[model samples]
Target: MHSYAAVLRTPHALSTFGAALLGRLSYGTVSLSLALSAKNASGSLAVAGTALALFGATSVVLSPVRAALVDRYGPRRALVPMAVVYAALLTVFALVTRDHPGAGTSAVTLGALAVCAGACTPPLGPTMRTLWSQLMPDRRMLQRAYSLDGVAEELLLVAGPLLVGVLVAYAEPAAGVAVSAALVLVGTVALALSPVPFPVRRGSGRRGSARRERTTRTRPRGLMQPVLAAAGVGLCLGGLDLLAIAFTERQHQPGAVAWVLAALSAGSAVGGLTYGAVSWRSAARPRLALICAALGVALAAAGLAPNVYALGAAAAVAGLFVAPALTTAYLIADEAAAPDARTQAGAWVNTALNAGISGGTALVGVLVGTLPLFLCFVLVAVPALVCAAVTLHGENHRKRH
Candidate 1:
């Protein structure tokens, strides 16, 4: 009996680990796939930027709707249809983008395809985390699980681009897109059907979120506080990402771009581990917000560095805050979410972050082609500083509350 029990547990553990890995891989591939597509087809940085920005913007608008469906219909049910549509869109993107002539019409078509693809794939992190929170429920386990989730996110961000770069450099850019779609198909399907963990809320009136929604309705100004703060911070982070992109391209060092971004992500993985390991007894919001603000200022300074080496160093320091800020913001949202709006809160976080990134990219792309690289950094830094100031304000508000 004991041996059989141990054998059963091993498969479950492996399943969970596999699901986590696949989810992160799927999440991380989007950027690499887009970058490869734009670079290969259009051969223009501006076109690449357009693809990335459009994808992010579409995801921002689309993720909330997907989350709502996931909440109501269950992730498994939602994932089945979404995965099929998403894969089909990627197929079209890869095929059409391969031989595309660099023209205004091609750019528009590519951008439209990216948006459709982005909107279709539900935001994986929120859905995965929500499912984890249900499956693991013990506060300690949940904390560790979330940290691992963040680390997986960072890992995917690092690995996905590097892998796609290799595939593109060795075979062809179209190959990278094909591989990404295949992985998304395989991994997303695995995630949906994996029986080790189940949905957090099955839309049951007597059992789940309906009751909680009613109670949360009476709690102050509701979702306004956390949602606004999250969006503001997201805008700052997005600006930083764009600055990095512009800096790399302006330096005439396209190869270095992925490496620098990977370094920053690696730093965040370390930070997520650190945050998850620590056991704080009370709400760590004020302290976390302060830390995140300082991190933002530090990152902005990295942008001002004269050379790539110095910039990478600065980015590393800034990267330290990425996971912490993300984890903290998500934590705040979880605590403050209305019952009916809990899923929406997660979607808002996704949208806010993507919106911030898209906004920053669009704004920076205009100046990047015309200005000095360092100047672009300075421009990007301004928004980061603004974000830090907003976070500081949040800290003060929290103290009063």
Candidate 2:
């Protein structure tokens, strides 16, 4: 609490944090809003699913490129225009889909528009993270800030969907989509306008500096490890979500799916708060490996759960380790990446996570129809265990050097 207060007391910290949270909320709402709009327009769950999938695909593909731009040009110069364009694209998508329901050309246009919107969506999360590194030079305070951000994200995952549902139910699906766009525009622009100083790349202005820096740089070690581990975590989380739905449906308690999933997020929030509050004595890499192993064990327990109640409980336990592992991954990435490439490295973390989620969802979607759902949980566990092993191996290899 003191740490949070101190960080927020820094210049523009509070405003930047608030704006970034709002921007993230907009991001969290996008998939649900798009799906609801697509379903309303096309009158088919299949089309809606396809639209959401395409949006995720495009966003994942373009995230690194967007981050590199932020690193090269600074966030204010890069993000503002992207946010505006993204917002406009989203508005057009909403208006077109709502007014021309079931029109073939409209559907096709919506698909293309979603892809463009995704590509244009500003990299709010990564930018805020980089901002934290700038604002809070203290390693402990930085960890707390990252953990707080992660907790807020979990809350967004819960609240964003509920807000969209309320708007869709009480008003219209288009209203929800429009609100999402508005939030994105407002939050991202405010963040860009905040007084926080964006980190400028070292030697950015010197002629031929980029080539010199590239040539002089030693091969970065553990650069990909953190990213791969992050992806593994994402895979487990994606599978866990689908497993919750399948579990609840099998029990004929489909309504409980939200509660079950909430258990995981709630646990992660609690864990993040606790982890950030304490000062850990261990190295970040080893801690990451330990947490991943614990998470994997918890997930396996979830797989063996005999009932929905048991499954939710196990999931909550698994969630306890999620934020710690992720925070450590970010710490590792910060240490390993070149000074000029930090923002891009952070962006790669998001990219890997998104890719993992997409792959996990697709893989589980295929298996859920033909195999036991418990096996899906087992499948999720595999990635975490692999992440642990890889991290541990990396640590050992580094120690030998």
Candidate 3:
């Protein structure tokens, strides 16, 4: 087992990672803040929902495009402008709600700003993962870095909402958006100024030719295994929220839903840290398959719990695989991609994950009302299990080849 301290001890690692996390925290806050602010300003839940949907759609769907631009232009040249525009739009959105003061702001106006803001959102998470790869060339150390990064991100997402909750209690919801804007702008600037250099993918160069050359060496399917695994994980997690609520409501202990969800987060953090400390001989893709399989099995069985507490325990156990699966997917993508295309590769994995989250919610929403609860759990777990089987089959096929 390796000490995580060593990963942070790498030159500029702490400062760089901190900056990236700061920016990512904004992501956590923005959704809740935007939704609340839009609701308050427009005096309509529909407007707020539409605003959130628009923002999430643009941000999640266009992740790879933003990452590709960073790969082509490097972080400072690309990320700086993106952060600037994103922060500016967030500020504008914040102002709209602040100035409106329940005057019933137009849904179209809020939705438009949200779309624009999301479109300019920087690809901080993918960039940070790529940076970790650059900072720690050794795969083992890189694994630790990814683990630490993942754990911190999980915490930040939890904390960002809490921070917004506090802010909204004291000030307006728009204040949360304002704070998110500051966090991203400052963090992006610091990251851009960091001494660590991001290798830019050029149109014509040996560096640029690497990904082009890979077409002859590996198939597109071969490169996308990690992304598929990530998508499955996200899909399971997305379904979990609705599933947990349904379980809690059925048991007539709806308040326990928060604790159940919290258990999942706590389990993921512990699992991520533990997974990071170990030195594994198995390859990342195979590890990913097993991780997904374990999570699927756990979740499939989670539907049978007799009580809310038992269901929470099941959720915690299922959560154990979540971080390890994601960490391995990132490791695989980083290893598979050329230096120039690494960010985009990571972004593809990210895009798949977000899309899966959305799909999972929609899928579960439709099924939860129609099917039995256990059957719903089984259905949600299907994606992970199917993804695992595909990954293992692909691995074995390559071995046979």
Q: Per-residue CA lDDT of candidate 1, range 67-165, in tens?
A: 777766765788668877887888888887776545333778788888898888755677666665555545555566666667777677768877877
Evaluate model 3: give its TM-score.
0.97
Tell me how far the alpha carbon of residue 327 in candidate 3 is from the true structure, in angstroms, after superposition. Answer: 0.3
Q: Ranking under TM-score, best-scoring first?
A: 3, 2, 1
Better of 1 and 3 by lDDT: 3
Best by TM-score: 3
What TM-scores do the predictions have?
A: 0.77, 0.94, 0.97
Residues 261-378 of candidate 3 have per-residue lDDT tens digits of 9999999999999999999999888888999999999999998999998999999999899999999998998888878778888898989989999999999999999999999999
Off by over 4 Å in 2: 103-105, 202-220, 369-371
TM-score head-to-head 1 vs 3, winner: 3
Lowest lDDT sum, 10 consecutive residues, model 3, at 214-223
lDDT of each: 0.67, 0.83, 0.91
For this target, which candidate reaches the highest lDDT against the unseen true structure?
3
